[model samples]
Each structure stands twice: as C-alpha cells, then as structure tokens.
Target: MIFIEHILERPNKKPILIDLRHNESETQPIVIFCHGYKGYKDWGAWNLMADAIANAGFCVIKFNFSHNGGTMENPIDFPDLEAFGNNNYTKELEDLHGVVDWVQNEFKHDNHIDVSQISTIGHSRGGGIVLLHASEDSRIKRVITLASVCNFGKRSSTIGDLERWQKDGVKYVRNGRTNQDMPHYFQFYEDFKANEERLHIESAVKRLTIPTLIIHGNKDTSISMDEALNLYEWKPDSKLVIIENADHVFNTKQPWESDDLSPELKTVCEEITHFLKQSEV
Candidate 1:
C-alpha cells in the first residue's frame, strides 16, 4: 500500500511525500529517493519503480523539494516557476536533510522500516545533495547517485554573471517545458558561495565509508560519463555501472511511455536493487 501526505518541514512549509509500504512479515530496510533539479516524485516511471523497489522488501519515500516549483495546490509541473527560478543549492540540501530527519523521527515507529538501515538514492543534481548529506550525517548507511554532477560551480554560463544577477535583482533562464523565462535571483549564487566548502563533492565522497553506488549512461549528454568516473575515482569501493545506450533521465519522459521502462531504466533499477541487497552483507 502507498501512503501519500503533506509533511510539514522546519519553516512550516509542507512538502508532499509518497511512501510505498511493504506488508511483509519481517521488517524491511528503507530507501529515500531524492529528485533532482526540475524533477518531481510523480515524474515518468518513478511510481512504478517505487512499487518494484517496495515489492522487493523495502519501504521507499519519494518527495519534492519544498521550493521545487510544485505548490501545495498543484504539486506537479512549474505552476510557480518563480519559485523554481529562485531555488538555490543550499535550500535543496536542507530540504533533503529535513526529509531525512522526518523519516527518522516521525515515520520510525509506525512503519516497520529499519531506521538503522536508511539509504538514499539521488538523481542528477539531487545526487550531489545526497553525497554531501551522507558524508556529514552518519545515519545514512548507503548512498546512490544517478547521473549526478561532480560540481555545481560551472552550471552558470558566464563569469561576471553573479554580479549582474545581484545588480539586476533577478536573472532569468528559459524553461523548455513551459517555453517561458524563469527568474533566479542573486540569492542562489550567494548561497553557493557561502557553502562552497561544504558543497564539495570530492571531499565528501572521499570521506564516505558506507556502501556507495554510482550509475551513469555512457550516452548521457547532460552529465558526461567522465563525471561518473570521477565519482568512482574518489571512492574506490563504490560500484559504478554505465549503460551503453542510455541518455540522461534514463530514457523516460514527462508524459511517460508504456508500461515497460526503457532498457536503460530497467538496468538502472536492477543495478540499484542488487547493490542495496549486497550492501547488507
């Protein structure tokens, strides 16, 4: 069964959560999936993937970032593109951490999930956030990142862009989905600058002693295969799997395809399942 609800966070803002429960006789491990920038829980084949993982004797929670363009009214798509534009790296990291806190405190007793066996799976930019969190928080026993970026500093186009953003008070980027311009204020850059040291993935990955999984598509155009290699290089113990024909997003779409996941996504899910199970040993 699936339990969906709006959970309140630190600032009193509620983020939607999709909890897939397992009815098995024995207690199961917990896996929290974090969606990346421009992504949500209900996107594409995520729900089906969640069910598959849950059926494999695990409880999974998938949620949206409080500021991830999804409002309480309509938690899908960019209805509030302004929020999307104003989103920053620090805020997303905090939101992920907040979810972790909620899982440990609020959902620990009711569900038969093993609080001590908490693991995380992050997609794209969300992977970066998970890496930082897992390194700092000893609670996370396992970590996984799908097509994650190695660095966030070069995401912006130009050098003096930070100054321009501050002077103008708002900077805009084109959203292909809505065909509209989205505004990102100066605060986004300022947040990164404030936490540059904390945001370093290389340092965090090096410190990670827990089982780690890194999956990437060799054909992914958004984040190069080299980035995945870089992640594996930092943590030699990490398991790295690269799908030959898969592109970014794992060949899924907004509207979604048929019941079958693209060959790439299927492999990705299987790899995750195998790694998580092996981590138990």
Candidate 2:
C-alpha cells in the first residue's frame, strides 16, 4: 500500500492538509472523507479507518478543511484560532469543492484514482458540508454522513444568544478537550444568514438523488439520534444505520494510543466499505 501526505494549495484559499491511502493499483474507486467541526484528517482512529478502506481496495483521500484551525506546519490542534473563528458553512463547501476538483483533475491522473466512481463521507459538521456539496455537484456518486447535523441555522445559537452574539460581535465556545476558548466571529452568523437557503441542510438532503447512508451513535450527546432521523426522513430512500451504545465519536478519542481500530470504529469502517461496494455493483 502507498501512504502519502501533502498540502493542496489554492490562490486565495488556505492550504488543505490531505493524505492519500491505497494499494498500488492502476485504477481504483475513490473515497473522499471530510473531518467534522474541530476535527482534523488525522484525528483519533480516522487514519486507521482510511487504511482499512484502502486495504479493502479503494483509494481513500482524507483532508482537513482549510480554515479548521490547523496550520500547514501543524495539522493537528487549534494552532490557528483566528481562521477557526472566521470559518462558516459557505467556506467549508468551497473547500470541499476545491478538494473534489483537485481529485477529479490533478490528483486523479497522478495517483491512478478513478474520478468517475467518486464517493464522499463526512462526520458531524462535515456531514452537513458534504450533503450540501453532493446536492449541487453531480460528480459525487454516493454520500455517507456520520453523526451529521440536520439543521445548520439552529445549531449555532438560540434567539437570545444571537442577540448577545451580535452585540458582542463574537461568541466563545470552550473546547473541552483543548481548554481553549474558541471564538466565532459575528461574520460567521452573518454568512449563514446571507446564504441561509443555500446552507439549509434539509433542502440539500431532499434534493440529493444519490445513494445516501446516514450513520449515528444511539448514545451521541453532541448530535442526537434525532438528527439522523431527520436526515432519513429527508431522504426516505437512504439507508440509516444506528450503532448501539456508541457515542459522538463512536468510541474514538483524541490522542488515541492504539494502533488497532477501536471496536466501534471498526464497525463503522466495515459498514461503509459494504455500502460503497454495493454502490459499485
């Protein structure tokens, strides 16, 4: 198998940190993975998951969103909180688009990746970004969302909180793990309001015609199982898999110590591989 990590740089956009995994096949189906909010490509057991999928005979590309608080030199942790503060849904969509375009055009030819058989998977907030992208970009053939948020506008704040946020011009949410006060600039809210229709996750899910898979943990506290139910309801034809006793990260944690996949994440990777293979046939 081949494992390579590189930076994808664009003119005006922040450089994206990406890693590719695959056996040295002449051509193979491709999987593009998006990390969740406050998540990076190399988070926890995700690298193990990518390796498993690659060994299963698909080329997997996992990336960090450009403005996801990580710098090029340091791909993990909140090194660039300023960028993180300014991040919004629209920028994330553009970042995903840039990755897809790079995969289809530049990365495809160079890496022997099959552009025609592309599939995308996103976790948590990334799930919402992928849904919005797949709805508009016909290049994506299949979609899988893990603990994804159903409504973007509602997740940010309550009406009273919004008033306070606007008055303060920023809102701080503490990162329990990092112990850092993460700031969300008022522009983040302004961006969402300006493109509210475009950022509506339900509308995007409703328009998605591709084979969709929704996976969530029954015990998730960050995003409830109800969000998964909403996603399934929006696209009744999509498959919804509920992992029993799993939590938000599906038994995976940051600063992960094990080389082997955690039991729950292993199940997730297996289910995803099966879903992608079914789509292939």
Candidate 3:
C-alpha cells in the first residue's frame, strides 16, 4: 500500500493537509473523506477507516478543513481555537473545491490513479458539505453521507441564544472530552445568512443526479434520523440506511485504541465499499 501524506500549500490562505492512501501499483477509484464539525481527518478511527477503505481496492483521500482548529503541525486536536471560531460553511465548501482541484492537477497523468471516478463520504456536518459539493460539482460521481444533518441554518440556530451570541460576538460550547469551551464567533452565522441558498442541504440534495447513499444511526443524539429521511425524500433516487442502536459517531470515539473498527463502523465501511463498487457496472 502506498500511503502518501502531505500538506497542500496555499498562497495567502490557510493550507490543507491531505493523505492519499492506496496501492501505488494499480489503477484505483478515488474516495474523498470529509470530517464533520469540530472534526479532523485523523480523528477517532477515521485514519483506520481510511486505511480499511483503501485496502479494499480504492484510493482514499482524507483531509482537514483549513479552519477546523487544526494546524499542519498539530492536526489532531483543538489547538487553534480562533480558527475554529471563525469557520463557516462557505469556507468549508471552498476547501472541498480546493481539494478536488488539487487532486485533479496532482494526479493528472498518474497511470495508477483512475481520476474519472470520484466519490465523497462525509460524516455529520461534513456529510452536508459533501452533498452540497456533489450537487454542483460534476466531477463527483457518487456520494455517501454518515449521520448527516439536513438543515445548516436551523442547526446553527441552536448555538447559544442568537441574541446573546450576537451581542457578545461569540458563544461557547463545551467539548465534553477535552473539557474546553469551544468558541463560535458570530461571523459563522453571518456567513450562513450571506449565503443561505448556497449552503442549503435539501436544495443541494434535490439537485444531485449521481448515486447517493444516506446512512444514519437511529439513536444519534447530535442529529436526528428525520434529517436523513429528509435527505432521502429530497433526492428521489437516493438510498437510506438506518443502523440499529448506532450513535452520531457510529459508536466509535476519538483516541480509538484498538486496531479493529467497532462492529457498527465496520458495517458502515462495508456499506460504503459495496455502494461505490456497484457504480463500476
């Protein structure tokens, strides 16, 4: 397996760090993995999941959103809270476009890479980002969302009292594991308002013509199953899979110690691989 990882340098902008995982000797389809809110590429079993997917005969490109509070040096945790505070949906969408652009240029002539077949799988908020990107980007041939949230504006509304958030110019949400108060700058909501139509998930889903797979945990507390149903309903041909007793994170946590994926996540990976493989026909 060829595991090529590096930081994509950008001019006058935040740099993106991406890892390309696959067999260097064979031509392979590509899958880009997007991490959710307060999420990074290497979070939890994501790297393990990326490896598993790559090992199963596909190329997996996983990366961090430029402002996901992770710097190139320390991409694991919330080291740059200011960046996290300023992150918005529009910036994330731009980051996805940048990644796709980089993928196209960097591997334009690589015989081992089948660049024509591009797919995306995003978790939680990242799922929404992937869907929005797929709606507009013709290069994406397939999409698989894990525990995705359907409504971005509505979801951001839950971030502290709107009036207070505006008055203070920021609000804090506690990260249970890190015992840190994650700040959300008012600019996030401002950006949402500035481009609400562009960030709308349902509108984007209804616009997608490619094969789409929507998977959600029945017991997900962060995002409800109704959101998943909404996505399926918006897209006439999309498929929805509800896993029994799985949570928002598919029963897997960060700092995942074991070499093996949780049964639920393993099942999720299986579903993703099978779904992508069907397109080969």
Error of 1 at 41 (Å): 1.2
Alpha-carbon shift of residue 8 in model 1 (angstroms) = 2.6
Q: What would the TM-scores of all predictions be?
A: 0.93, 0.97, 0.97
Compose the digit string of candidate 3's lDDT tens values, residues 89-148.
Answer: 999999999999999888889888888889999999999999999998999999999999
Model 3's lDDT to the true fold? Answer: 0.91
- Displacement of residue 9 (Cα, Å) in model 3 is 1.2
Local distance difference test values of all predictions, in order: 0.82, 0.91, 0.91
**What are the per-residue Cα lDDT tens digits for candidate 1 across 124-242?**
99899899999988889999999999888787435867667778888887879768777787777777888888888899899999999999998899899999999999999899999
RMSD of each: 1.8, 1.3, 1.3
**lDDT value, candidate 2, whole model:** 0.91
Worst 10 residues of 1 by lDDT: 14-23
Residue range 1-281, candidate 2, lDDT tens digits = 88888788899778998888888767778899999988999998898999998988899999999889999888888989999999999999999899888877766566567888889999999999999999999999999999999999887666778888999999988999999999999999889889999999999999999999999999999999999999999999999999998999999899889999888888999999999989883
- Candidate 1 residue 280 C-alpha distance from true site, Å: 1.2
Pairs that clash in candidate 3: none
- Give residue 156's error in model 3 in angstroms: 2.2
